[model samples]
Target chain A: MLFKCLPPGAEIPGRFPGPVHARGKWFTIDIHCHVRSDKAAAMVEGNAAVSHWFLETAANEQSRRINRENGARTRLQGSSPEKRIEDMDRMGIEIQAISPAPRQTYYGADPDLGREASRAINDFIAEICGRYPDRFVGLGTVPFQAPELAVAELERLHKSLGFRGIEIMTHVAGEDLSAERFRKIFARCEELGLVVFMHPDGFTEAASPITILPM
Target chain B: MLFKCLPPGAPIPGRFPGPVHARGKWLTVDIHCHVLTPQAAEMVAGNAAATRHPREVYANERTREVNRQQAERNRIQSTSVEKRLEDMDRMGIDIQAISPSPNQTYYSADPELGIATARIVNDNLAEIVGRHPDRFTALGTVPFQAPDLAIAELDRLHKSLGFRGIEIATNVAGEDLSAERFRKIFARVEELGMLIFMHPTGFPEARRFADHYLVNVIGNPLDSTVAVHHLIFGGVLHAHPNLKLVIAHGGGYLPAYSGRIDHAASARPDCCEQIHRMPTEYLKQLYFDTIVFTHHQLEYLVDQYGADHVLMGTDYPADMGEVDPIGFVEGAAGLDDAERRAILGRNAARLLNIEIPAAAG
Candidate 1:
């Protein structure tokens, strides 16, 4: 049976996971969802200083509690592609446009470390999309603190991995997104038709209760 | 006959401006307006080599074009009090709390030059406001590059000239406003109970922003965001809880993105070394102006920050300012009469401590 809330003129695609909702008829797509690969989680775990900095400087009590719960769930649902697909199917979601969690953006890490983390995260995302082509599309992350490195990675993700876009935080190291230093990345994104998903990172100071909402 | 649109319970002030739809009985104050006095213009023009740094730092074809267009428009409208008054009347603005144009802050100049320029700008603003007290009030400029000089001038403006507030740039010679050296100025301003109008100068890091006029558009708000973050995380807000601060460009990206900061602080121990409260709580203590361009955005600001915290702002006389200040507020959905009144004028009036004439019984 078709979902009652489905919009008019819906058509179900033949390959839909279950019989109830047809692809064209009632499929739902969530454009702004996040995924956390085990490799990315390991990377965050290894970077204790940066993680501590984020927790100390960015997160508050409520966020800490939520992160503890979400962190546990992300380890299960975010890491295993099968589990993610299962969750999506249960929720009646057809496709999810997934990017790495905002905490994984890691613009504050050392430039080389940041690039390494981004590569690992982006590769993991690409692998998930490759495994479930119909169910998931991938967005990549880059070390925005180093603009040149970010642009270079953007090109790689677009050309090789086929990422549709890259995610960026609103500010880098307290520098505004409009700073001239980041022009090359913006220019490359414009030239490549790469979508830019602007997200906010935790505030720069180590002791505030302000952080961007997770998409 | 009474104005049809005035809300039923609104007090009919004895001497309000003539009726305008949805804005008849209340005073409409524009707290975020800018002015460029002729003397400050002449000073910047005459000091070509000194003033060239801001342009040269971002020398590009687009930057040149944007700067040229801004200079032309500002020369016309920003400098002329008569032009400003006419525009305010057209926009249905009753009082414009005019501050010197962001460029005139001149925080980058040598200490002496900065102080002299500030005095000239302040004197000109005083003269303009003095000429028409009912239509205008003014905020004085300070030589923030020199904090001692800035404090002295702040004292002079407050004591001698009766200025109610002081205008400052987001940064002082590339230093954030939250730096320790500037603490004295903040403390003094708090002690004086004077309003701090925090306006962004040209974004210090404008290299990527040269194209698309993003320098003013995105850059302005970003500057304010950075400044406020420093104030919050750096412990300025914690130290002086009663700063009476008003951030332009709707407090930049802070109000909307505050929840994230809270999350970061909670999950990490290192993020909370300065203050113990949620950043939004401190943010609530500060005020914002409604210059975000859309009614929905303004309404969101009002919702996020209560009506009392959001004041009416039109970047005044600049091309980027709200074209119809009154209509922008009136057009916003979900605002009741009292909310509209608060945002339109009452909030600003209360902040500035100006008494609106009560209605004649």
Candidate 2:
């Protein structure tokens, strides 16, 4: 069979498994998956609109199922290292390159708030990847509206946290991706060879339907 | 052997000639050309020492020199009606839909100054187009930063001055075109059935693009791209489905990269929160020009958006504009005779509702 779901460490029995070596098996990687941090969740918890919307949506249902299936272990929530590894094993994925969920970037917030939120998200992602060294890599988030701060965070993510790249929302507070304000960010990314993953946020309007979704 | 310079006013001339003919001939209209009105020139000259926006200031001697040369070329080519007509004849273009040069839009100015400048520019353009009604039609400028004033001027231009359309910049003082404040102006444009020609001026945040002419080469197209994305994702197009919006510079980079937007919208619910359809579907509703500078580029534009949506555009009177627009269209590989005719003039004629001469072939 081309696809199979095997338990982790099953291949080597008594020893920790190396790469899966079942006959005719191939290693697979999913690069676009997103992860959420508890700190990021707590920050948005006070926003009643987002919290209520999330509780009523399919996303919340999925989150509940993951938590329930993992026996309510705090570290086995959807974005937790333990949960990610368990899911990866079940799905036959060899590695997963995780990026901050777009909502966690918080680029629309005030500059200082945006910077602090981005740093926290980046730190959490780095820690998650650190725990599962061979099975995961992380991409950081930056507060692009503040280019100077964004560049600083970008460098710290690369040099200190060992992040491979950054994820950016399609627009920053209604400004286009091509706005001259972002040139420094682009230049720094080019210099650092950081892969830019452009993710879309809710459309430019505050009345966007997705605005109801939890951040 | 494939290219020929058609004689002016000649019927069935070897080259494509201007749309109007003494005898019957195929019409060729340049829809994307610009003219700098005398009023605009006077204002700029009068305001030379005024406080300048940081983006407008030249950063280095080399940058100043390059801009000076370009500005000189623009002054000579853009200001004189006779020179423009002669160039049109030389290029085998018959009619031109002239708009005030993008620089003259001047949305950066204070509301009163901007409104005054727009009126002067619009009147000057009206006068120029009036002199050669057979050879020219004009699009008006408005004080976009002041929405109320812009709507009033739009009504005046459409009713009194007989303009069929208005030209606008991509943004007004760093505000996106999709900002809620601009919705009324857009609704008016739609209600009045006025065509929109969106051109970009100096890009916001152009400090890095100060050197290498990157501002024009890269910045201009990026501005158009940004404008279109906002209009699409912000639900402007969704609300105004019949809006006859035309983007210059071959619809910028949007037509080429729209698939990425479509993919993003499909994969994420947030991206489609406003519009139900994909971004490319909205792009197809818009029109593009042939100012992309090369046959392959024009061909790609025609392919990405159908030939009927593509029109002949020469930045006109600017150094960067196509010098041989007819030749460029004639040389596009794989275009059939009908496709060539549509792109050259028929499409623009239909869009502007210009009556073709009965004798035209």
- Summed backbone clashes in each candidate are 43, 4
Candidate 2: list runs displaced more than 4 Å: A1-215, B1-26, B44-55, B58-60, B263-273, B294-297
Model 1, span B91-135: residue lDDT tens: 677888999888788887888988899999999888988999988
- Chain A TM-score, prediction 2: 0.71
- Model 1 segments more than 4 A misplaced: A1-215, B1-24, B44-60
Q: What DockQ does candidate 1 score?
A: 0.05
- Backbone clashes in candidate 1 total 43
Docking quality of model 1: it rates as incorrect
lDDT for B255 in candidate 2 is: 83
Candidate with best lDDT: 1
Model-by-model lDDT, in order?
A: 0.76, 0.75
In model 2, pairs of residues that clash are B18-B94, B19-B27, B19-B94, B24-B359
